[model samples]
Target: MHLFRGPGFVAGFSDRADGSLDFSDRTPEEAGRLWAGLPAVAGLGLPPPRFAHQVHSTTLLRVGADAPAGRQGQADALMTSVPAMPIGVFTADCLPVLVVAGEAVMAVHAGWKGTRQDITGRSIAALAEATGVSPARMQVFMGPCIGSCCLELGEEVVEEFRATDPGSLACFARGARWHLDLRGLNVIQCLERGVARAAIRHVNDCTKCLSDRYFSYRQMRGRHGTQFSFIARLPEEGAPSSGAA
Candidate 1:
């Protein structure tokens, strides 16, 4: 994956599929104690970042400086053309999709449900409508997630792929059950949706295996921290350099 420079935001994921935050690890009171200090966290030199409660459903919003706060919408993905308002997504084994268009960038949380529901397409369409950017002009970065080598699936998942994209079944391997490549499926979706191949970069990092720098819920047996993937359009004045993790 391309290195991301901070003063940006982060998304966390688990290893297996449920890569959500381990609230049990810290009580709401403790989290509140931490949340109380978020402004101080915001005080650090970085672009102001915001996120949403992803529901694995296809709901995308374009955030501006005046947008309301408090998870006002339900969406698996979010995009923004507004400068300095960074968008972020959370995942573990599921894919963390980041899209950039000139000065605008988008962060997507694409779990299997989001993927099957075409969350990427919805987000892109919204951005296109909002910014008038053609898909050819877009750059996509597919971050590390669960690889097909270990992302075994059942008939339900397979059926979902077939229902959405019948040809995607080729990415599935038959065994005692089936091993699938979710990243590959996402790549196919990107290409089919008009994102140029050369413009799309796949980090190909597997969270389950790359435990040193990333958190894998599957490898950790459902008890682990979540790593974040975030991007922000630089401000005209004194923007931080760009990198990736």
Candidate 2:
């Protein structure tokens, strides 16, 4: 597993070393035990992890302060300001985004579908409204996903981003085939949402290219295996305050 300490909270991305905790293969009960086995997640006294069916939709769910079971809701994004509430998203190649404000944390799963819908841009706006924080004050971390070298796509995909942003056409390239820069697109979204350039960080790994370290749905040839990326808000006082927690 890898950890991202974005200023005020803990964000983690699991890897192949985490075993087959993909919810697509094992039952939820079984997957839970596998996830809890990771050293980073073990014995931290974290709150129950929550996830959705991940239909690649743009639905964003916010967890309330008293929400312990994490709502069990169906959404591609989950956010919470409640301390210890670990919100997560499972992905192999698709982007996993974590946004953190002073007291709020958000986990986003941005696949092509959700990306086309501008989920990251909307998440910042939504979270800012919910937490009453400036978007510039939030730090964002984008986890490993399929990079452009490995993200070949049809011309239609290129046209899709162009039709949506037009300026986003810069992020797409024409080679033997078209390639979409998912990470770049998300970064642009954050910038558009008023997040500072320095506040955004990316793991910058290509999952399909580095399948040995991380799981890749494409590299695995449609395998159900996936790694989880999570973020949680820690308590105000005496909280560890940073680094791969």
Q: Which is the leading candidate under lDDT?
A: 2
Reference-based lDDT, residue 226, model 1? 65
lDDT of 1 at 101: 67
lDDT of every predicted structure (CA atoms):
0.66, 0.81
lDDT digits (tens) for residues 68-150 of candidate 2 = 34235678998876777788898989999988888788999998778888998998899999889999898888999999998
lDDT of 1 by residue, 132-180 (tens): 7887888888888888877878898898788887887877998888888
RMSD of each: 5.9, 3.5
Measured against the true structure, the TM-scores of the candidates, in listed sequence, are 0.77, 0.90
- Count of clashes, each model: 17, 0
